[model samples]
Target: MKDMSENERVARAMMATGRYFTATELREQLGLTVEKAAATLGAIRRCKRYITQVIGSPRHYKVKVLKVLPSPTWHCGEVAPPELTDRQRQQIHYLSSVVFKPSRGIA
Candidate 1:
């Protein structure tokens, strides 16, 4: 089997976990520069089968990978989101709410 590309590895990791991630986070996690992170995200977007929409401001985005069953064989390639379960959908709704909650503090 051929070795996984850097983007593929990052994509797999993100897909395994069902949580949103920003470009900055991706840069930090992948040790990439700002430009590289942006490029990488574009690459991921092209390959993602599900969870294609990236919602957020220009600088920040909420991204997640739908849990998918692994192929029968050891197949490591581009990343794609899976069909979301009802529970998963509920979780995303809740998390998105919390993530977008404004902080209440002294101005």
Candidate 2:
């Protein structure tokens, strides 16, 4: 049998509980550092396939796992970049506008 990755282990634990879990709880249960727990949970939440919901602010978040997703297959080629959100596009436009404005001929 193949060993489970940390992400799969975390997902299984949350799915078994069927309740939201804070980083603190995960850390204690899985013997993980606070940063590791938080990072793992954040990645799971972003995937949206494994996580049902995410609660609380960035500094203190909680996650509820819906199901354990199969590990992603690895590829040996370049991958497409993620699409940018509208907000990100707007931010980029705003920054470019501010940075590349024509200077009023000041000596």
Candidate 3:
């Protein structure tokens, strides 16, 4: 598995709790620098899938987890390219015949 960045770690921790937090609270709880805590919280809040901005002064944010399922048409089996249409097949046939035909004029 890939290693998580500090930002990702902080976001995941916040998401796990699913609670509202402010930048100062993050700094105090995580022992981060004032700027780092504010930056991390700002970055996390921008990711709509993971966090949401709550209505208030001083900017409170809450983490949210969204469930996503694989598309119904998606499959893990072998994949094949789509077959050529009749018009495409005809074009290929014409081009092939033109290229491979005996060069009577040159000969």
Candidate 4:
């Protein structure tokens, strides 16, 4: 039997639950603080390929098992970047319009 790491254990627990969970629920279940839960969840998501973000909310995620065969040449499909929202576009435009002037003291 192999021992699982903390994050792996968390992922397994979530999988066992067979549903998506919010950070607060995970925190309560794992006896962790909000910040710790969020940080731990974030790290787990980054390290575990099977763990995927839920489409509706940033705080939610789901674990999906994908079986991929090993091959000499295997390439995953590329995903296009999400389109910028109106608020994001306005922020970008505003920032782009601003010009930074070097101070006299700065070399």
Error of 1 at 9 (Å): 0.7
How accurate locally, in lDDT, is each candidate?
0.66, 0.80, 0.64, 0.60
By TM-score, who's the top model here?
2
Query: How many pairs of residues collide in each model?
Result: 0, 0, 0, 0
lDDT of 3 by residue, 40-61 (tens): 7777666543535454555555
Number of clashes found in candidate 3: 0
Pairs clashing within candidate 4: none
In model 4, the runs with Cα more than 4 Å from the true position are 59-107
Q: Candidate 2, which ten residues in sequence have the lowest lDDT sum?
A: 71-80
> Highest lDDT among the candidates is held by which one?
2
The whole-model C-alpha lDDT of candidate 4 against the native structure comes to 0.60
Clash pairs, candidate 1, are none
lDDT of 2 at 36: 100
Task: Give one digit per residue, the lDDT tens place, for model 1 in 43-100.
Answer: 7665643344567876567666554333333445434557999999999988778876
TM-score of 4: 0.47
What are the TM-scores, per candidate, against the unseen true structure?
0.50, 0.58, 0.50, 0.47
Model 3: ten consecutive residues of lowest lDDT: 65-74
